[model samples]
Target: MIIQLLLIPALVLAVVSSLRSRTSLRGQARRKILAVLTVVAGVLAVMFPNTLQALADWTGVTRGTDLLLYALALVIIYLVGSTSVRFREQEARIVLLARQVALADAALRHVEAMQARSQQAADQAPVAAHRGVEGTAAAR
Candidate 1:
């Protein structure tokens, strides 16, 4: 009786879903396959819920929905933890790269300062040497 009651809403949803599926052949095909599979599984579950229950008991799961929710929660937790670790690792890498860039910039400034000092020494050396020569010539 409840299944009969469920049929109207299900058919309405299916029709509305089909109207939306005209945009993509793959989507339509997927929906058709899903509908067939859903009907087959629903009939099987209704007929043999006990058989599936036995399998679940062997597997130590009290209920199928409980097992499904547990599996989903485990996957979500693992993904979120891995994503957080990867994010922190990337942030550390970025900070290290920034420090390396600053070090390179400072080294460039140091090299420029050394080059200026070299130029000053080269210019003064020639002038000082010529002045020494003039002093000796003037003494003579």
Candidate 2:
């Protein structure tokens, strides 16, 4: 009775959160299906408590609750593994994007610097030519 009070709400919230999570369309569909199945199974368990016990007996488990605990453990393990892989993939993509942005910025800066240098040289050319002409006249 006490366990049901705790586990039912926790499981429902977990499913709700999973459904609300951002994922691909296919992933969202899969989670929605899983949530529906979870609710149906929960309803069946509440309506026929003896069914779980019979299933436990058939599966060679000592009790239905223990079987549930075992199943939960496997799920937790799988979620952790999948989350780790997803996190690593996201991290790699971020690093790649950062590198791309940095390279693009550096390239832009280099082009601007070259343009400024060329403009400075262009501005100085007339002054240099005037100085050369004056020197030639003074020498003559």
Candidate 3:
């Protein structure tokens, strides 16, 4: 009886934590519905432990606990696979963004270098003109 009571709060905490951590509205809603269903199922399990055994027997499983364990394992595997896929996708996006930033920085540096060269040439123009005048006057 104590174990059954403990399961309720444990399930509630797990669901609450999962729900709070979700970033998307759709995800949260889906989680909320699943959580509600899970809690209801838990309650039903506590109220009628024999039902699990009945289900196990109907499904050709030897034991209810084994059935529960199998289901839990499948859920964990799915979550791990999905999380890995999301991580890879996020990593790819980060790499692409980094490359774009680097390209933009390189273009900016090239433009600045070109501007600096033009300014240096402009600064020498008057000196060149002065030298030409001096040479022409000396010739006259």
Best by lDDT: 2
Ranking by TM-score: 2, 3, 1
TM-score of 1: 0.48
Model 3 weakest 10-residue run by lDDT? 13-22
Expressed as tens digits, the lDDT of each residue in 35-127 for candidate 1 is 577577657766887865664565567875554454345445544554565577678889999999999999999999999999999999999
**Model 3 score (lDDT):** 0.70
Best-performing candidate as measured by TM-score: 2
Tell me which of candidates 1 and 2 scores higher on lDDT.
2
Model 2 scores a TM of 0.68
- Candidate 2, which ten residues in sequence have the lowest lDDT sum? 14-23
Error of 3 at 67 (Å): 1.5
Candidate 2 stretches greater than 4 Å from native? 1-43, 46-48
Alpha-carbon shift of residue 54 in model 2 (angstroms): 2.5
Residue-pair clashes per candidate: 0, 0, 0
**What lDDT does each candidate get?**
0.65, 0.72, 0.70
